[model samples]
Structures are given as C-alpha cells and as structure tokens.
Target: MATWQCVKQCGACCHLDPAYRPDLDEYLSPEEMELYLSMVGEGGWCVNFDRTTRECRIYPYRPRFCRVEAEVFEDMYGICPEELNDFAIECCQEQIEGVYGDRSLEMLRFNQAVGYIYKEG
Candidate 1:
C-alpha cells in the first residue's frame, strides 16, 4: 500500500492526540527523558510549536515514537485542526482494540475518549 501524503508544515499530529507509555517513565534514558519533558507541554504537544511556523524545536532528536510514517488507510484524524478532537478519540479506540482486543470492558465512547488521557496526566 502506498503511504498517505502527510500535510507538510502542518502540526496536526501534535494536536491530534497524546500517546501513553506505561514505560514512558522508564524507556526514555535520562537525556531523552529530560528532552521530552522539556519539549512536551501539559498535554504533550511540543512546547515550542509555533502556530505560525508549525514546527518543532527539537525535530532532529525527536523521540523514536514521534517518527511515524503515514500508512495507507491509516485513518487520519488530524488532517484538519478542527477535527483533532474526534480524530484523537478514533485513534485511541483503534489503539485500545489493537492492544486489548475488541472485548475490552472499557466501553468505547468516541467523544469521551477524546483528550481522555489529558485528564489522567
């Protein structure tokens, strides 16, 4: 499958959703952790993303997880800033299902899932 064309100069993904790693506190080495903590703001968006430039300050040494390739039919929810909330929920549910299977007791509510992790942090 061909990869999707990501919008260049768009910071949609940064605002789309946050990724949670139980090992976020463990996997990252000291320097990596410090860099991430310094770059990520309250909800994990790049701290230095200039809305005008739509760029990250630490793009070169961005976390390994941040280097995502756009996959075919990958279900983009962050193409437009306005749809970020809904897109985040869809992405989260997809991830939850992928990990815990389709039988998770956590009832999937699209709206409720949007920014859900933000509250936990």
Candidate 2:
C-alpha cells in the first residue's frame, strides 16, 4: 500500500494561491481565511516559504491549515484517519502537479518519497 510522506526541499505546498483554491471559505473559518490570505505573497506563494531553500520558514509553528495530520485533515476535509494516507497522497499529487508540473522535479521527488510510480503519457 502506498503511504504519504513529505519530501524534503519540495515546497510545492507553499504555492498558496487562493485563486487555485476557490473553496477556502467552505473549509476555513473566517479567522483562518484571513490568516491564510495574509500569508500569501507575490505570485501567490506563501510569505513564510523560503524560495532559496525551498522550505517553510515557520514550519514548526505553521498554521493548522498547513499541517498534514490525520486529525487536522479530518477536521478540515472530513477525511477519516483510515483514509488519510491515500487522501493525502492524492492531494499532494494534485497540488504538486498544480504548483510544479506533472513532470517537475518536485513531483518526481514526492512520488518517489511516497513510493508512487506515475507513468508518463
């Protein structure tokens, strides 16, 4: 079975483009929405993301929305703990592909880290 794991140096999730996530109001509370919007920087990337290092500047203290924990996923997206692994993998795959391309190094690294073998078409 495939499991979900974050690959180091892959900041694809840092591409916090609100335009890409139109349902922000649906999942996030008003305060969280405000904070989320505040974190967005130029080109929709997260202000806390370090482009030079490709990592989150405030990783240890990142908001609940930025975490991938099963409980957090359940609260945010109604994804059960049993389903978290697969769900997270799919989410990461789509987000990584959206932020970087499907063929991008970030996607490759994420897939590899998760033991996913995506075929190029």
Candidate 3:
C-alpha cells in the first residue's frame, strides 16, 4: 500500500461527496464559524477550502474531522480506491431503494459480512 499525505492543493475529498458531517459545528471559533457559514451560504465547496487555491483557507481553525490524517482504510487499495467504489455502490443502492423500495437488503447484509471480516482481520 502506498502512503500519502494530502498536498492540500488537491480538493478531491471536497468534490467527492456533498454530505458533510455536522460535527464541525462545535469546533469552530466565533470568527471561523462566521466565515464558515458565509462560505456555505454562497454554495461553495468546503467552508475552509479555497476554491481558487484548492487549499484550506482556515487551516489553523480547521475542524478535527478535516485535520484527521488519511488512514489505513483511506489508503487501502491505494488511496481509498476500493472504499470509494464501495461508497459509490452504497450511495447508488440507497438512491435506488429510496425511489423504489428496500431491495438491497441482501446486498447490504453481504457488505456487512465482508466488513466484519475486514474488521476482524
């Protein structure tokens, strides 16, 4: 497996998904919070991200979630390739079920079984 540190110039994570966790609400300082909210209102990417520079604008006051280093799971299959594929599959399945009905339960169970093996190993 290859280990990598975010160059910060790459905004891949921000563009990968739109569902950001709200855990950051508590970590922002007053000024940082204001800036975050303002950026969010403008329909920009991550609140701390600089779209032009593709770097974190508020690195000093970044939330814990953002500060977390890319982990083993993240690097697994080389820079989270497998995990990203799994995430995409899960998202598609969820959307399909939402539009239709709960049809992916067996697939979900299979994924859970695989996840348990991965976790235990």
- Specify the highest-lDDT model's number: 2
Per-residue alpha-carbon lDDT of candidate 2 for residues 11-101, written as tens digits (9 for 90 to 100) = 8889989999999998999999999999999999999999998889999999999999989999999999999999999999999989889
lDDT of 2: 0.92
**Comparing 2 and 3 on TM-score, the stronger one:** 2
After TM-score superposition, the amount by which residue 120's alpha carbon in candidate 1 deviates from its true location, in angstroms, is: 32
Report the candidate with higher lDDT, 1 versus 3.
1
* Cα error of candidate 2 at position 66, Å: 0.2
Q: Model 3 residue 5 lDDT?
A: 33
Ranking by lDDT, best first? 2, 1, 3
> Worst ten-residue run, lDDT, model 3?
1-10
Off by over 4 Å in 3: 16-44, 70-121
lDDT of 1 at 116: 43
Residue 97 C-alpha lDDT in model 2: 89
Which one wins on TM-score? 2
TM-score of each: 0.38, 0.95, 0.36
Task: List, residue by residue over 4-117, the lDDT tens digit for candidate 3.
Answer: 233335443443222443543455556756655555523435666677886777778664334433353353223365455455445434433443344455334434443422
